[model samples]
Target chain A: MNGDAYWLGVASGFVVVGVVIEMVRRRYLRGRFALVWILLGVGAILLALFPRLLERAATALGVTVPLNLLLFLGSIAMLIMIMQLSAEAGRLRERTRVLAEEVALLRTLVGSADEPRARSIAAEDRDQDSPR
Target chain B: MGTRGRGKVLVVVPAYNEAEAIAGVVASVTRAVPTADILVVDDGSCDATSAVARAAGARVATLPFNLGVGGAMRTGFRHAKREGYSAVVQVDGDGQHDPAFIPQLLAALEHHDVAVGARFAGTGDYVVRGPRRWAMRGLASGMSALMTTRLDDATSGFRACGPRAISVYAQHYPAEYLGDTLETLVIARKSGLTVTQVPVAMRHRNTGRPSHGSARSSVELLRAGCVVMLGLVREWPVIADSSP
Candidate 1:
């Protein structure tokens, strides 16, 4: 990578790290999930600072170019993040189902408890109407 | 057994849009177990299931949306636990599960934490055919080997749960579709609770649509298989051994 490209990568990595920290501080991102973002940021910073390291790894991995190696690693990281997100989504879905069920049960119980009174009042009205 | 001989029993009926059958089912359960409290959990039925169930002299717990059988049952279990019921008998609201066998289930619960009403224990005409039957048999065999006990019908929802089982399930019940029975048994057994099966005959649904018809059985089987696999890989809490 060129000097300008390397510096741009380093800056972008720092920005990513800063954004993740801000999210964690604001409680927008959970600490457990933020760790992944932080680690990715740090890895990006390390790779940007050591372009030779990427070249050596690419050679070891039988990649034709260092850029291809970077892309492969990035894709793998993206895939892992997607999997983690999907797992979290599944958990949230289950929790939502439970909460929805609880709410429905409560509504039914309260609603039915009042239903008898309503029915009796309606019956009384019907009786009066029948007399008329 | 009468109410005096047993602790408080709550009969939980999880129904989904079974207006045509809910009333009769509720009436039958009430007639069979006069002392036991009956709760019909209407799972967001678009029909008049909640109203019909209420009219049939059973307490109705209406969900705002359909949460499937597992979700509905979890709500019922929570209610039972909150109300301090000593045992809970789960009967389907489609008029399928026989309320007459409720006493047998409760009796089984005296020696076990969970009592499941088996439909194919050489007593009932509840026949299982095609791929669904094979899936059920595979699940039963797998669970039997895992628990080191014989389970004839692992998919039967006509089961009774003691206080221990109720409390555990109320807190940690799986919300997977059609996987509740198998998952509950696994969880109960792993928690060191004794699980046994009682013979009970089941009739076909009298009204409304069957949730798992012949067309959807394959999809249900696939989903159930995935849920079981997920349950196996998930970490489960190990309660203290409470079996007698």
Candidate 2:
């Protein structure tokens, strides 16, 4: 409604955000990423104070969507999904690297002509009276 | 450079963790090819394979680690070359390859530079057991035909090659993917050497199970076929005759 009413909401939101940002900083978002989140929080505050001013900056960044209500929720969801996918990809990539190393070691250890365990045995062994 | 001991053929057996069958195989080979020396390339067997091979009197060359089948065979060929064996026959440590048939392969090698056994040349003594093997053998036959300009068996592991042939294999053996032997057959023919199928007898292995189960077998055969087809397309001469 009014600027004071918005500030009251903003103050409570900051407390909630401070907790979330701590989670992101200490565990999820670290280093430069935490700095990016801080910048985003500062930008949100700047837009709250001068709602019409930062619209030019957002326009320059090619952000066309409405920063309020439903459109904002959609963008937030999209960003979270991208983060989840990126983390999963990082884990998968690490696993693939480990598997590749294992395969290489096996290739080196097992000489190329692998006569699988069975292919190496005789009919005599199968017959019970093993070959002498 | 030349054939060893005025034509003393050296058979190279590449074995990995084949302790159970190594001694029996060594004994059979020695009994079968009395004069020919046997060299076993033991690929870091966790079991007693190396000890058994050595005890059976095969000159066991221990690789520090497992180098897969291609590397083991290559190592054996290197030794075979040094030992002056005019020719090298690769026999598996498993009893699947009948050593008695080595002479038959040698006889065929008299005229041809490289002779490989054909499991489905259509006239083998024993039964192939199930319909799956029958089907696989049929596919292998067809694959051989496509790669070598109409040959009987391309998947046969039992093969004999002269020094010229051995040198080529020792150099370009594909280490990673298994079942790429047909590539060698094609390369051998292209290298001005005749690649022929020697209809020697083959027996089933008595020990464990096949490394490639039915599903893996099918997938591997398909992959091998595609790779071989592509390779032959690149290397197959434009002209027309097939028999080599």
* lDDT digits (tens) for residues B124-206 of candidate 1: 78776887687677777877787677788888899999988887888777766656777777677667778998988888879
Candidate that would win on lDDT: 1
DockQ (C-alpha based) per candidate is 0.32, 0.03
**What are the Cα lDDT values of the candidates?**
0.80, 0.66
Model 1 segments beyond 4 Å from truth?
A1-64, A108-132, B1-6, B130-132, B209-226, B240-244
In TM-score terms, candidate 2 sits at: 0.59
Clashes (candidate 2): 28
- Give the true-structure RMSD of model 1: 8.1
Question: What fraction of the reference interface contacts is present in each model, in order?
Answer: 0.69, 0.00
Model 2 DockQ, alpha carbons vs. true complex: 0.03
